[model samples]
Target: MSPKKATEAPLTRYRQTFSGKGSFGEYLDVSRRFGKDKEWGVRINTELLNGNTAINSNDMEAQGIFANIDHRDKKSNTNLLVGYRHLNIEGGARWFSLKAAAIGKEITKVPSAPEASKNYGFDGLAKESEGYIIALNHEQKMNADWKWFLNAGMNSNKLQRNIIGASSNFVIINDKGDVSNNLMSTQTVTKNYYAQLGINGNIKTGAVNHDVTLALDKAWHSIEGAKNMYNNGSMGSVSGNIYSGLQGNNVWYPSIETGLSSKDQYWGISLADTVKYKKAQLLLGVHKHNASVDSYNKITGRVTQTVGSDALCPTYGFVYQPDEHTSLYASHSENFDKGTIVASKYANAGEVLNPAKTKQNEIGFKYANAGFLTSLGIFNIKQANNIDVYKGSDMYLQQDGEQEYQGIELSVNGKLADKWNFMGGLMYLDATQNKTQNGTNDGKTVNGAAKWNAVAVLEYNPDEKFSIVGRAMYTGKADIYNEQLQTPSYMTYDLGVNYKTAFNKTPVTLTAMCYNLTDKNYWTAYGNNLILSSPRTLMLSATFDI
Candidate 1:
């Protein structure tokens, strides 16, 4: 059987190949205020959501609870806050092919299309995750010219997934959807902790007034898991037609084992100062960052690779407030952090690369008033790139070149009239990959980066009891492949309404929204994969206060 060359032709439409059984979500919140001046308060929030995803053969459930307490004392000029959150989730998993062909269109060229199913996925698959986070904030005034603050947080999460059998990345073969299945399961736990302390002081250098800040910060992160990575090569075959519905069977397969993986933490210290002279303000700062990473062999549980880096980064900016309603600004910044971990399929699998550095610069202006506000900006960013390089028979994942992104953005927001208000923004972007191997893709546009995008929203409030809103969003053409093909531009619209009233003297609010009002069919680009856009949806909600 020969593979169909359907994707070679321009993709005109994205066929919808996913369906969901149903979905539901709900939330509750409560708050209280106590203290002589009502400067102390506490709040609690809870949310739950469960549903079968639109993606065929996938379902998800999630729940979370959060609480926070805050306090302020005018006598000491101090404030404190503490918060905690817990969340859990369960879901199925799937992946997409790199081909740009429309979904369900691949199997149509085959002779056995009727019996073949366009939908492909796993049956004995399960994914579960749980996470917790705690945070603290404190601020105090040491004197009229100086103040201090502290911020701290910790987060932990665990994930357990059982892939009953592995499948191909959803591809069409000989007009049929074919996949190689294998058993795999893994459990991973990750933890992150961070803290920061800073002090702010007001000083005068001759005629210039300055606000200076000095800060120190540290962080720790680690990952541990059982059978962190696993692959059972070709345990079985799960094949079907791409044009028809392919239901997965509840067949359990044997499990396999791999190695462990971990990422160490990083720390940073910085100082910043803002100098105000006349109508101009200049900002300057520098940061020292250090980080490390480690990877281990899955089967041996032994360290296979380690990498670390230390660097000094800088930040600079200037703002000129010409008038009360208008201002201009420009800024530059740099960052460094741990690099990518090569995937198991790559020649450099389990290898940790050195830290990557990124730099950015921007210039912008803003005009503001009571009834309206608008801003325009241009920005440029450059970062090291990690790409898959074909070498002989095996693909090697390595750091190769630099990817640059340059863009211009304009936004407008605020009231347009006595009963009308509007908000919108437009952006034009040019992103390219440079300095690849042999310059093969030196000037190609980065995948999934749209050249132009815009959004506009209008709202009307005729009275205190009701409000209406309308919105429009547009995305221009984007590169879907390695500069070989592109996805066409698309637009979507939305409409919504809000009603506020008193129910038995209790304040109540109700909202209804219709998304993708026209039910337009479109395609979304995720990296190199082409995905069908979501269909029209309606949502309704109510809130009550007593």
Candidate 2:
């Protein structure tokens, strides 16, 4: 290839095809060109889910297609893309059974004794959504000293929440009051539309460069929803014996003083700039965000609650390169979130929350050699008074309420030798809830905050057609439920192999994986309840390219 052709190769278009099958599902992907100058192309993908190892069922189907138009070599380079997707999910209700132990109470795994899992509330609940997106990107290189680009996109989606059937011994208790057999068969619909536009460019000076970008985005969403709670044939209170179940019951939906629907809207704008020189670079960014929600009382045709807020956030950073192979960097950044709506199990179910924010600072240094990279860093993140509806009443208030995570992270990646490659990282975090509330919970370690987390993976390829890989992971102890419960640290290992060969002049690859090789039983994440990690399982996959 000539110099110019070699440099432009990265920007050229190419065709791709792949198909694979595994325990989770089967998938097919394809992208090709068709049109004059090969300016137009299309991509298609489809995947179906049918198996889950947790004894819980996983059933779903996802499919997507996209088309693109390119004008990259023109004076005014441009690209346009449009796509559509459909996703459906159903099944997977592995409810924990409450039981009495010799010492106290315990939550048992899915049972086979009574011979049934009673957690499938309102039977076969499913979620289905259809989404569409359109985007356009344009760029211009007016001269060697300057370049600019513009990007715009729009996305829209419709969703359906479905519920049908009944379960035995249905009882869901959270921060809210006891909800017994209230989750019945019901359905809801939601619609959302989003749009964004951004413009960016860079200008070169004598020995420096200045780059800047501006972006604006907006979203509109609405929902027509209801939660159904119904009694089985006969429902009544437990006889103080969890082993025995309820006999009689009443089923009905709890009526709010007024029927209500949820609607929300958001808008945001951001600006960023960077200055780069031979040995150093400085960066700055800022964002202004605003959002509002309306709880429309359908019965009275009046808006019951109006919640909204606006805020501004900023970030700054600096990087210094001592040489071509090493760099030192420091940064301060901010995060702004609109927050999620509470689930029906909470007292504030379906209620809108004020925005949650966090500020973070970090310093790090990196070194790179031929085909290898290593980095080490330390950082702290402070979250503003956040809200976890599961922990408090309709409103969870912990003033000054501060939880902070301070940690050190190290990572290494790339080829270790001629026939070997590896990548891994280790992180140690001292997470604390400080100065947030009364001394009662002050200085306590945050629940689910693992003290240590580490992961490593290595791969060896003796030849061009075969490879073997191994991975190891470890985690430290953590507190749960405000430190009421504790979880022990755990480690796991995984081994895998891949082989590539030609079949009938077509390339084919096979992969086999053994996860949790020790078959260790451990807790993964703790929230409203204990989440169990996957047991030792084996998976095999095959892929073909045409």
Candidate 3:
């Protein structure tokens, strides 16, 4: 290929991936390229998935496949895309269990709790789900200084879960949760549609440069699930010990009750602008969001209650670049989110919370050169829990709180020498509840929040024939629930190697990696059950260019 011709590519391409895992699996794709100024083509891609080959899982043995097709066209500065995707995931779910010992004692999450205190946990669950999506995207270069785009997609999904297991003091829900033994086998399905449109461009006036963006978004979602609840647990005592829990007589089967359903929709818009003059740059943006939710009663055939909300979020930032190698910046941002359906554990399950709002302020300094970059920043965040209010005729109530977090972060990435490169970062955060109901949780550390964390990685490459990489990750001690349940910190490492060669005169690569290099065992989750980090494991793979 001529040097100049090499710079001008084609408008179509094909690619495939073939792998052997005892049995074989593959992925294939054929599409028109997006390289030239004007192009149009159809592309089809598919993959066969087996969860066990990708990573360790506590809940599922998933085996499913997905495929998508796309037709893309580009005319000058304008582009359009039409696509469709289908997914089917069905698998046998795994059961989970936890012990009281995992939550307290010297080797446990809490200091005051005694070891081997009546252990209770739950198990036995499975799930099957399928989904499909249709989408369209368009972009137009309205003018020299302005461009616009719109993206829209509709999705439909159906899911079913099986609760099958012994009714003990505590049976498992799935890997992530535990429910009252009063829980039952359940099924749920949801549908959603979303669309977004935006316009962005740049313009300059005198010594100042400006870039701006304006956008609008809309979404609709609905969910309905069938539920079952088990009743009839006879609390009994044995050996002078009272073993009264959800342990059942196994005779009273759960009755399928009225399943729950909810519908919600969201509308949002954003406007932003960036301005620069000499060594100074400034950014300003504002976003408006509105949402509404309705709960439906199948038996009543009526939409019971509604939660509606609207919010405005704003952000501003400024940067000073005294030179090419150094920068100082400060920023403030606001976040607004619509509350999700309440979890079964919450006292207010089934109710839609008011929206949640959060704000953050940050300042940072960075130094950058040809081969290395480093930065340090500090931030403070304040959050208001969803504004909860009692909606008439609803099964759930109101719960609200406030929280704050202050943290510092430092990061660095660069080439240490001629052939060695390294990257790392460190963070320390202090998070606490500022206010809550009845002041019961005031001043307590938030759950799942870590105090300090750090990570680092180093890579060596001498001539590309072979390269080696080493990585280190560390997590500081964390609180599961206030000071009641705490988990210790842990550090783990990974090593990787890659070699390049030729197979049948085609470029081929071999890669191998060892995860959890030191096989460090530490608590990953301090929920009802204890979950541990993955132990040391090796993975190897080969890739070929055909």
Which portions of model 1 show Cα errors greater than 4 Å? 1-22, 52-58, 75-95, 99-122, 162-185, 225-228, 232-243, 249-260, 343-349, 388-397
Q: Which candidate is the best by TM-score?
A: 1
The weakest ten consecutive residues by lDDT in model 3 span 1-10
The TM-score of candidate 3 is 0.77
Tens-digit lDDT string for candidate 1 (1-546): 111112222222211111234656666666666767767666666666666554444556767776666677742333333333433323333343332342235433212212111224555456667787777777888988898988888888776554433321333333344533334455567788989999999999898998999999988876665553443443333445344433344344445343356667788889999999999999999999887777876667777777888899999999999999999999999988676776554556667765778999999999999978999999999988676554542346677677899999999999998999999999999999988778877988887889999999999999989999999999998874466556678899999999988779767778788778887766566655445555566666767765
Residue 282 alpha-carbon offset, candidate 3, angstroms: 1.4
Question: Where is model 3 more than 4 Å wrong at Cα?
Answer: 1-25, 29-31, 34-38, 41-45, 51-124, 162-184, 227-260, 298-301, 344-347, 385-398, 526-530
lDDT of each: 0.67, 0.61, 0.60
Q: Which of 2 and 3 is the better model by lDDT?
A: 2
Please identify model 2 stretches exceeding 4 Å from their true place: 1-24, 34-36, 51-71, 76-91, 94-190, 227-260, 298-301, 385-400, 435-439
Regarding TM-score, does 1 or 3 come out ahead? 1
State TM-scores per candidate: 0.83, 0.77, 0.77
The RMSD of every model to the true structure, in order and in angstroms, is: 9.9, 6.7, 7.2
Kindly give the number of clashing pairs for every candidate.
8, 11, 8
